[model samples]
Target: MAQESKPVAQVDVRNIGGIDEASVTLPEGVSILTGRNATNRTSFLQALMAGLGSRQSSLKGDAEKGEVTLVLDDETYTRTLQRRGDSVSFDGDPYLDDPELADLFAFLLENNEARQAVARGDDLREIIMRPIDIDSIEAEIRECKREREELESEIEKLDSLERDLSDLETDRREKVESLEAAREELESVNDELDELDTGIEESQTRKQELENAFQRVRDARSKLDNIEFDLETERSTLSELKAEREELHETIENAEKPDENADRLAGRIDELRGRKRSLDDDINELGSVINFNEDLIDGSGIEIYEGTPSDDPTDALNADGQTVCWTCGSEVGTDQIEATLDRLRELRSDKLDERSEIRAKIQELTDQQSSIREAEREIERAQERLTAVETEIESTESRIADLEDQIESKQEEIEELEQDAESIDVEGYDESIKLHREANEIELRIERFKDEIEEIDDEIDKREAAIERREELKSEREELASRLTELRTRVDRIEETAVEEFNEHMETVLEILEYENLDRIWIERRETEVREGRRKVTRTRFELHIVRSSSDGTAYEDTVDHLSESEREVTGLVFALAGYLVHDVYETVPFVLLDSLEAIDSDRIARVVDYFRTHADYLVTALLPEDANALPEEYAYTESID
Candidate 1:
């Protein structure tokens, strides 16, 4: 698509940061960048276009020597544009190598010239009159949207790692308490056993003393019986002597009454007296035993009485001592009686002492016997107690055994518990395990969250990129659409002017000094777009008439090729005059560039300059020194390039 009449005018070069470079201002309106011809003016021209990188010709310049900038009507795009060994680059964009943007860039340099130059043949001229996209802003927005999608996905993974650590710590604490409780129970059982052992030792010592006391009592009882038997025999001898004294006294009285033999009577009397004495002594020998039976019974409070004995009393305690009837009146001797009495007294005393001694012994032994019996009873009880204690000890041992078995079983259970508790790692290991588990869970959640966010972000990035790209496409569409409208307007104008008829009229109007007519002077456009390709507006050029040189009558489409040198220059000047009719200017700057125009007559150049001054404010030309006088005074500004 073609921009109306705004042609690129001038460029200003500035050393912006001002680091050792010179700056200069180029003029608008047909400035000739002039110096000596070989003094770098052409290279300066190359430098001018180098500021717009693709504006350089097929031959571009060196980049490393300097940086450049171009000022356009909208904004300035600056770059270090240059060529490096057959490659063109602008701000590191490979200008010559890129076909799309580069082609559009190259079009600016060529299209700025006249369209007749394109019809006459210029390489990049045909493309620059068209636009690719209306604006470049849409391309930048797509780049930003894609970058945002990648950043959000990384944050989600960190959250899941924190949760798993909490659960593992709780299980480890319970097992330690159970082991402590078992230890306390065992301490209690050991204390109970200690107390029971002390009681059993004390009971055994007391039982031994009881057994010794029972044996001592039995020995004392046997000794008291033997001593009592000796005293009883001695008292019985004294009692028989008292009975003989009574018989002797009775015989002595009966013999005195019989008077038969006096000598025999004397002898019998002596015998009877002696016998009586003996009997008396014998009777007295029993001493107080016979008589003391009553006294002893009365004085000692015994149960025996004085009476004739019938055999011996069976229950006598003092049977070794005898009883006598001392109060029975009978003849007896005094000396013998005294002796018997003395002996009897001795026996009675012995019997009494023996009875008292034996009785005392018996009483003492009886107490001892009772103590012995009690001791025996105690021993029996102790035996029973010892038996019971042994049974208790056995039972306690059995209980201890059972406890041990239980402990063993509990130990096995503890082992099993320990095995199960392996899952509950104590000693701070549980905390680590729990933390790892929490971390793993958090990691999984974070990964899933990241995946979800990434999917959404990627989709959004792609959609935004597509939208931005569509906006660019829409800008191109708008450019193409506007071009279609402009092309349609141009077609309508041409058709309304009756292009075929206009061509005929234009031929007549241009009949002076011209050699050959253009092959295609009238333009036709096809405004329809191709759906899939560059649907740029198109124009067709046509020439319904030909021009000829008046001298040779030779014909050519481009007057520059076939006409005489002056004819060619006059025709080009005529074309420049016709362009003044077509172009509009608020402050008119009518300009042209003509190569090899030295063949034109000075009179014709004067006419062209006068024609320009009538309609324009500024007219500038590039020429050799001889061409300066061809313009009227002040009608044109003249600049010469060698």
Candidate 2:
């Protein structure tokens, strides 16, 4: 809520200070009272202060009776000061009677005094930050800070919980990986067992086939033996042939194989080398183009281009007129030159990389070619041995064929005898039986690993739920922090704006009054401690300082004590006016009653009066005729007091 302006309509005074009786008509703005010493100017202003609820006014000269009557915008109120015995009694309107107004009046009276208390090194904060209810604001701020501290502590605890949750998550991840590996291994084992079962079945079938072939060989042997001496002679030759055939088989198995791609690798090397040469040429061309552009930009080849050198190379090129190309000496546009330079730089970088890569590939192919040549030589020796072995095997097989023909003719005679014989005992069936047993064991182990993985999965889900609860706590703490920030910001803004508004008006008034040696005035909020009985209480308040510049180009700050007597009076008045403005005193009492401002010079007094005319609706100042004449012509209301 804003304070509305209530200008005083009139005032009647009797037996107040030096005033015996006086009735004054106050205009809307800037009313001057001209009087000599002891003409009751001070008394009249005092009465005005008292009528506005100042407690400082008293009955004059022990006359025992004084009263001030004030006519405000809506009502007439009178305050009478009466002395009975040793005490004084004040009677006035109860609604208008406010102790706060008395404090404001006291500040103004102190401000206008010739020996200003602020100028005498009193605490300036106590004067300027008045009517702010600092005690109440400080209490609320303290409570807010306490609550904020508690929230911060809780947040720290939650952060610890979050760290624990993170550790649990890490453990869960490791367990999950372990479980996944176990499951994968179980699946691998299962597949291996399945393959083993198939291998066993195939082995059993092959065992039966070997038994059949062995039985035929035995029958043939029996038939050959039947042909006595002839079979014996033929068998000796067959033995020799079979021994040679065995040697050939061993030789063929040990022979080395040749690399079929030896020729292909050599051709790739050649192709890469040719590409590398081409890339080198491209790179060289790009380098020349880049260097030519650099020379043009650097002004090293301007004479070759038939253009004069300028401080800035880009400025030397003209887009409209005929311009010679720096490298080709052909007429070209400026845009074309810039585009060519940019393209050449890009091409140079690309070609350089391509050339390096091609060279590396060429080196790799050369190494491969050397390895292939060594392999080819080894293969040539192995092929010669293999060919000799094949020739020996063919000769041995020819002798064996002759012997086999005779044996087959005899075996036909013996086949009828062997058809009645039982099948010979089969061998190599033990390995298949052993593999079947192992597969059964592996299948059992796979089932156990799967069960363990399921148990680990359950533990991971529980840890994830705990992490969700931690997140909820973190979100609650964040809300508390936001609210705390808002509270602190509001408190600071209120205090800052109050001091800032006061300083702004104070500096403006000081400038208008032409206060010398003072450039700026402001209030600084500070924290201080005072002793209350045996306890120390900390308080926050404002302090005043004035900035002044010396003749030697140095700036310094000092309190109001550094000001002269008249300067201090002006400072005090300006400060008082600033407080009045900050607190919106004009709404309650729209009059600034000032008197005995003779210490201030006439020019400054005129300016101060002019300022009051705009800020206050009723400006009543007590001045001598000389000081009154200094006021502007617009302030025409003046009353002479006798």
Candidate 3:
């Protein structure tokens, strides 16, 4: 079968770290990136590493949005990093390669174990052995140990449950005994309640009879109360009748004779009435005279005679010259008419005074007559009232007698009912009530005992279920323990195989690099006890040791710590390369990236580069211009960055 070329053919970077946009086409064999410090050469290599599946990249600052595209022999792969997220995609097959291996073998950047091992004061064993999957083996062992611990925990739980099962059985026995006792006590109570059932029933029947008698008493009492109320009403009616009769009798006595003062006033009024009639006639005559005189004085009622009157007092001498009186048809002098008119006026004034007095006397007589009439009417009414009172008094007395008889009869009935009620035997009723209450209490006790027994049964079921679960867990624990042992054995076998391969490859690489004073290099599996706080931990690890031949031609084994800086650096590098080769990392990734190898001299760097070229299908290195220039011209395809 023909060997396949490396997957990465070209890398195009945009907005990654210090590089805004750059594209570098990778050639076959070794390639070197030549740039001064801070020239973004490391960024370019990191992009390749990222495209090959490394997470070390800046997604902020100058490289806020970055993308690295890798041109493969038959396809293209691209990785993008944005502020939100990152993604890797491919046009053909997905980049199924492990990104962790890329960090392990693909990059020799600062702080990488391969580069730091030279200057670090820590043991070189861990540094040399880092590239292999020993940590993965240790992790597997830890997982097995964790599984074993879990099995042990389950076994402990099972043991505890088994121990608890004994106690649960003991408790169950006690509960059974308690349940039995309670059931026996409840049965005895139920028997006692059953024996009292007949007595309770008989007492209940008797209680009903007594209740009926008591109800009869209550009814009789209610009837008696109604009778008493009726008697009281009748008595009140009789008293009212007597009171009305007495008042009527007094009124009749007082009205027996009319008012004497009225009679006397009537006699006086009769005399004054006769005088008043005479005076009224006089007043009328006086009024007529006064009117006549007034008319005569004015000469309104007198006919005028056909004569003229003289101014003199005695001027009337003949009928033609005299004035004639209209009533008498006689001639009269003015002096004579004046004298008659004056006399008539005086008479009328006197008659008016007498008439006023008569009218006063008549009015007094009329008032007396009215008083006499009112007294007669009162006397008649009193006599009628006295008759009515007499009739009501007889009727009320009859009703009162009837009410008294009815009340006495109701009282006798109520007394007989009360005596009968008192004769009913209440003792049997009370005894029945107490027996029923006791029966109810016994029933409750029986129910409580039943419930307790049920609870005990439930507890027993729960304990039995727990014991069954413990058995299942015991079986599971056994299976887990078997798996844990198998895993541990497998881990041991894999460790032996990996350690042997790593030592063989390191020996070969050390020889090829021409490391002086090194006879052989190998890795040894070591176990040490360490105390971390309160815990004593057994730590298993692989340590790197080298056999150095002294000037006396004798070989002795020593650790990597006694080696020089360049030797250590070379040893770490070769160890990493050996792990890569031994584990077939190159078969999948087929690439290694190296940068900042200033700790090793130029000549040694060329040898390391040459070793990498033979081992990896594709190798990329970042170095300063001078370092790039020192590499063999044909082996390095140099790329420069300004």
lDDT of all the models against the reference?
0.36, 0.60, 0.62
Candidate 3 lDDT, 335-386, residue by residue in tens: 6766776676556556544554465445445554666766787788888888
> After superposition on all CA atoms, what RMSD does each candidate show versus the true structure?
80.8, 39.1, 63.2
**RMSD of model 2, in Å?**
39.1
Local distance difference test, candidate 3: 0.62
lDDT tens digits by residue: candidate 2, 150-238 = 76676576566556666656665675576566556656655764565455435566655544543554545544654443546555765
Question: TM-score for all predictions?
Answer: 0.28, 0.44, 0.40
Show where candidate 3 strays beyond 4 Å: 35-38, 59-63, 83-98, 114-486, 518-521, 531-537, 546-562, 625-636
Show the lowest summed lDDT stretch of 10 residues, model 2.
106-115
TM-score-better candidate, 1 vs 2:
2
Best by TM-score: 2
Ranking by TM-score: 2, 3, 1
lDDT of 3 at 583: 52
To one decimal, what is the Cα RMSD in angstroms of model 1 from the true structure? Answer: 80.8
Model 3, residue 147: distance off in Å is: 16
Local error of candidate 3 at residue 561 (angstroms)? 4.6
